[model samples]
Target chain A: MSESAIITPPLSDDDIMKLKIGDRVLITGKILTGRDSAHKRLFDLIKEGKSLPVDVKGQIIYYVGPAPAKPGYVIGSAGPTTSYRMDPYAPLLMEHGLKGMIGKGVRSQPVRDAMKQFKAVYLAATGGAGALIAKNIKSARIVAYEDLGPEAIRELEVENFPVIVANDAYGGDLYQEGIKQYRR
Target chain B: MRRDISHEKIKDTVARLCIDANYFLGNDMIQAFKSYIENEESDTGRDILKQLLRNAEIAEKEQVPLCQDCGFAVVFLEIGTGVCFEGNIIEAINDGVRKGYTEGYLRKSILSDPVKGKNTNDNTPAIIHTTFVPGDKIKITVAPKGGGSENMSEVKMMKPADGIEGVKDFVVDRVLRSSSNPCPPTVVGVGIGGTFEYVAFLAKKALLRNIGERNTDPFYADIERELLQRINNLGIGPMGLGGRTTSLDVFIETHPRHIASFPVAVNINCHVARHKTAII
Candidate 1:
């Protein structure tokens, strides 16, 4: 399949609508990195009516917690973590204008429903392909919760980061579709 | 004659093994991928396999980790009856893990408390499973298990009537449910018979076997081959993106069971399958 190039941080409704299940995409531009702990904290802040550490409105959040970078690298081996753990917090984030997510694994029905309602999309980066994925991230810096270690929130400037459209705004899910097509 | 082993030696050795296991993909795993690439029919599956090969190469050449998770450091120690240790074995293992995780630049993934949500900082308190043997030498095996795949493992108590076909269904069903979550093509480990707890242990121990190795019993060995073919036939493919090579290998370990219970367990390992052994 030919790869599509998409830029992030201002992902539009039209851009998301054009994405189909199974379309490979190389996303470039700024994205936020967070995983379980960060999501919990973000959810708490949202509930408290306090401002989040970073502006998540219309941002693409990648579910990852990278290894500590060695001396010469901008980031260590960084790849998508499982997405199901984030399902509980996702609908809340979508209501807050989060436009997209990047992770591996299937999402819950609520998350899929939120994507359809809020016009968000879910992309999947190859799991266990961390070293290769790290090469695509240009730079990274912690934006919040540094004490969470790898789970800290970081703003990453990525270049041509590879992902596949796993869930689209129109209720398409690649995990189910791919399995149904391939499963005997 | 009894030989005394120091904690420092165990500590240092554990540290080095952890680092090596995390940084280098096992040769057996690499070979499995090479063969899968040739056998996989789907373009996407083949491409994913190729990318994994490249990822391993990059990790080895650069001395980075094969995956960012690095995993919980699990140690299996076989202590000889004739051997004596000068210091605490558990302490030595934990110290070794702490040094390995910190010095190797691997991720510290353990939490001190499951509910409190605090990092242990150095990934200490390694899960050490020790068994006593008759030899004079202690053998240590380190298998760093990732949570993504570990989460998919299962233990079930089936009726005796379920029998072999039942075991097959359970094993294949577990794999299908795991899909791409455990990062197929996966190495499936099945443990049959044994008591409930022991079966789970057997399942995990089965994962330590090399992908090419088979059970000694022909019956179980044949079952392994059949399960492998069945799982691959699911077309879950690599990364669940869809394809022919969902599982690289299936391993089965069986033990005598109680009259009333048939306990089975499935342990899944990602393609990396990082394990290394040392004898002292």
Candidate 2:
């Protein structure tokens, strides 16, 4: 369980497939947060040729709608929601320079195809590990869609974020592989 | 002889229950997670279950929610015919929900329209089910039903010949199809026999039972055990990552049905199964 093995440099499709399930990743970098409502707004903004509140180029986005923060906290139990809900808007975001996604569950074929085409990756934080995930966020600020409340797009600074590689840029999906291996 | 209960008490109780249930995964759920971890054959699945267990501990200690999807509130009330309330019970429940969402920092996941996608701020207008019982006290149970698991719930009116085997098949099929989507390992609640709507209601009510608890009836208890074993045999495992424990538990509640009809409903609850009850 070498750290280097798990932390492969973002790779091409063929290279990503070489990695298997159970690999742990300590992701360090910029990742945007969005859920269903925010995703719709983002795609709408892109469709209108309007500027996105945050530039998505080479950035990862986490699909989450967090609980409201307690008095002293920056965010509440902030974990991944179901990724399927964002399936409709994901490819478009990938086309606009989004390189990675962090959420739970399986992705649709279109989203997988987008990952292959854009050299992006899909990572998954545990679905219910909200408080632990929130600990990774050092700061947070609302970027857009204030009316959406918890679903709004927020800029967050993170450190050593934990995720499992669900889908890699090379079109390898851990979900499918894992299920196949374990299916009785 | 109805005893009067104030609206304020109702509001406070609802708010507290909502926050408590969301922030803390019950002991039974935690035990199920541990069992999943110990029995899971896949390394990845075991790791995922371990993470889930740790997540629960973190949420409990920190007083933060166990999941981002705090869920739409489903409140079940068994009110005594002998108890009377001064104000509207439903409105008080909504007000408590508002305060709970705002002050407790739970997510307001409820939407005004499922199709139009209009969010009802403060997670208002709970799906409340009330029944009158013969006690002098009112018992309230709140279960925050998450969308992922809720979407997997289904009700089917099968021919009387379908019986227990048919029920088992349908439940397993649904669980297998769901895979990682509903955030396994999950608790499957089965409601059998009753009418279509009553079956669905029974399925939800069955979820309130503690994990691994058997139905009082020997016949249904055996069915529950068999279903639990079969579900685990599917190898869906934790988070569908692969394990020996795909389901934490399977609970069944049954009622008499028309001779021609056999209705069954299945409701799935994710690993972060949250429910709490209070009496007033």
Candidate 3:
């Protein structure tokens, strides 16, 4: 598939709606990172009606828990963790104006439904490609949940971070479609 | 009857193995990717495989972990009865893990408690399995197992009548349900015949086999081949984006079981399939 480029932080509904499943994309700009622990913390704050450390409004979150950086490096291998772990928390964030998510793996029905209704898109970064993906991250700093270690909420400035649309607002799912096409 | 092995040797070797395993994707894994790339019909599948190869190269070149999930350091030890250790073997191994994860710059992914969710900053408490053998040598293998694929593993006690056909179905079903969750193009490890817990252990140990190796028993070997084809036929492809290569290999290990019980366990290893070994 050919590539399309999108700059995040202010990803619009139109930008998300235009992305079809299977279209490769290069995402450039600042993105926030969260994984299972961070998601759970955010969910708890939302349940209590407390303001999140970082606003979810019109933002893209990548499900990643990065390795501790070595000396003189901005970040270590920063790659996507499994997305299914975040399914329960994703919809609520989407409701709060989260426009996009990047992770690997299949998501649940509720998550997909939320994406469709909320006009959010799910992007997939290749699993186990952390070293390759980390090269795209120019800088990374923890924004919140510092105690979470690898699971800390980090803000990363990425340049041409590669991804593919796995699920889009218009109801296309790359995982199901791709398997259906190839499975015998 | 006993030859002494130093704790320092074990610690240093374990540390090195941890770093090496995370940095270098094993030759067996690299070869599997190469073979998949050559044969994958879908352009996307081929491209994904190529990217994995490149990812591995970049990891090695930069001394970075292949995946941010450096995983729980799983150590398998075969200690010969003819040899004795100079210190606490388990403690030495854990210390090695602590040093390796911290000094190697690998991610510290282990939590202090499964439910409490506190980070074990140094990635300690290596899951060590030990067995005693007859020779004088000590063999240690470090397999850094990621959570994604590990979570996808399953163990089921089947009725004796379920037979080989039933076993095949269960293994394939597990992989199918897993889809991209375990990071597809997975190495499927099937353990059959042992008691429930033992069978699960067998399934995990089966994953330690080199990808190109097969079960030596003809019956189980044939089953391994058949399961491999069936899993790849699922079309989960590389990273489950869809393609001809859902599973690179299927390894089956079996043991004698009670007549009434038929236990089967499936442990899937993602494409990274990281492990390294040293004999001392």
* Leading candidate by DockQ: 3
List model 3 lDDT by residue over A1-184, tens digit each: 3466655667888888778898889888889999988999999999999999998888899999988888988999977999998999999999999999999999999999999999999999989999999999999989999988888898999999989899999888999998999989
Tens digits of per-residue lDDT, candidate 2, A77-173, equal: 8888889889999999989977778888888999999988877778877777787788887777888888888888887777777887777766777
**Sliding window of 10 residues with minimal summed lDDT for model 1 chain A:** A1-10
List the candidate numbers ranked by DockQ, top first.
3, 1, 2
List candidate 3 stretches off by more than 4 Å.
none
Highest-scoring model, lDDT:
3
Native-referenced DockQ of model 3: 0.90
Clashes of 2: 1
Estimate every model's Cα lDDT from 0 to 1: 0.90, 0.83, 0.91
* lDDT, candidate 1, B1-280, per-residue tens: 6889999999999999999998899888999999989988877778889989999999999998889989989899999998999878899999999999998889999999988858999987788888999978899999999989999999999999999999999999999889888988899989999898999989989999998799999998999999999998898888888888998899999899999999999999987788988898
Residue lDDT tens for model 3, B41-108: 88888888888999999999989999999999999999999998888999889989988998999998
Candidate 3 backbone collisions, by pair:
none
- For residue B181, model 3's alpha carbon misses the true position, in angstroms, by 0.6
> Which regions of candidate 1 fall more than 4 Å away from where they truly are?
none
List runs of model 2 lying over 4 Å from the truth: A1-22, B115-117
